[model samples]
Target: MKEYASILSKDGLKIATFSNHFRSEKGVMIITHGMGEHSMRYKEMADFYTNEGYTVISFDIRGHGLSEGKRGHTPGYEFLMDDIERVYAQVRADYPSLPIFLFGHSMGGNLVLNFLLRKPNNIRGAIVTGAYLKLGFEPPKWKIILAKLSSSIWPTLSQPTELELDALSRNKEVIRKYENDELVHDRITSAFFVNVHFAGQYAIDHANEIKSPLLVMHGMEDRLTSPTGSQDFASNSGDNVHLKMWNGLYHELHNEPEKQEIFNYEIEWMNKLLN
Candidate 1:
């Protein structure tokens, strides 16, 4: 069954949420979408989890989707983190006894990792795919300097993300649908850019501090975010993190041609943990 809801952020932004609740549920999975996208994009993924008897919850971070906020702008990175915590608190209040897990893609992956690092929580496990730890290509020094300066002076200054649309998946249909999705955007604010760029590094540096199991996956052929970032995180994170680098896949592993295989792999991992 599909359900819609909203929650208030610490600063009073209305975060829109979507969920798929099943009659019998093994656990709750809260999904976080990447930058430039919203929660509804994951409805298909939610359906997959619900079919396996897992209740799924996904939300639009303040500025994106049906949520209320400036497009591609947030006051700070902490606000975004607080939004996730609010959703978690809500899920805990509603399903107190069930194990809760997090799934984040791209920029959402970055947020989930940072949450695990800085926030204290009892989530059973976390899955991060194509995390935006670092860009696939080196950013120009001039652009970096401009972004830092702009963020300090005009934090809300927005710019096109310049993301290569075609690199998101090998599926042309997926790319076409994404291009036509009105909710899908390519804008990023200066504050959002600088904060997330640094937060990725912070998560990597503090990887050893995570106590719960983490599954980090990245597509080897992904041109959007560097897979080396996932490798660095797993290498530093001790035995708690399991890193999977899938060959011939792009940024969105769950949307890839072999997505069923990827989804089943995720379900199997979660099942093992539950068992």
Candidate 2:
């Protein structure tokens, strides 16, 4: 069954969520969507997990989707992290005895990594897809200095447009739905970029402290996040990490042609952990 709801974040921003609960209720999986996208996009994934006897929970992050805030903007970088914590608390309260897993994609993957670093003992395990541990194209030192200086002076100044590929051209239907959806935000703010960089740094700093069972997946052909990022995370996260690389798949491995294979792998991996 599907249920729509909202939770008041610690900062008082109401975060919106959609849930699919299994009758058997083996456990719970909390999903966080990528940047510029809403949680509803994962209805298929949630259905799959629920059929596998798991309760699925997905929420739009603050400043994105139907959540209360400006589209793609947060007052502070920690706002999203705090909101995630609030959602986790709500899930824990609902399913106190069941195992909890956090699943994140792209920018959401980055947020999960940061969250784990900040609160390492919160969840049982985590799955991160297309996480940006590090960028493929590293800007020069001068450019980094300039962005930092400019951000300090003008936090809202329009930063360089990072929209490289025409994401919509590949899937017209998905793009059309996204563009027409009132909850989706296409424009990202400068403060968002600054917060992203800070979050990335925090993950790197505490990579070794992440002791939970972790699964990191990335597409070899992913243009948004480099494979090196996943590699770095797996390599530095001690020994309790599993890394999966899909050749020829783009950023969204779950939406690719071989999505069934990816889903099967995820199901098996999660089952192994849950059992």
Query: Judged by lDDT, which candidate is best?
Result: 1
- Pick out the ten consecutive residues of candidate 2 with the lowest summed lDDT: 163-172
Candidate 2: what lDDT? 0.79
Best by TM-score: 1
Query: Tens digits of per-residue lDDT for model 2 on 1-275?
Result: 27889999877788998888553457789999987788888887788888788899999988787888767776667788888888898889988888899999988999998888775445778999988666656668886777677667776665334544433224455556655777666666667767886677668667898888888999887777778888877877787789999887777777766777888999899889877
lDDT of 1 by residue, 1-275 (tens): 26889998888889998877564458999999999998888878889899899989999988898899988888789998999999999998888989999999999999999998878899899999999998888689898898899999999999899989899999999899999999988888999999998899898888999988899999999999999999998988989789999999999998899999999999999998999
My TM-score estimates for the predictions, one after another, are 0.98, 0.91
Clashes of 2: 0
TM-score of 2: 0.91
Please give the TM-score that candidate 1 achieves against the real structure. 0.98
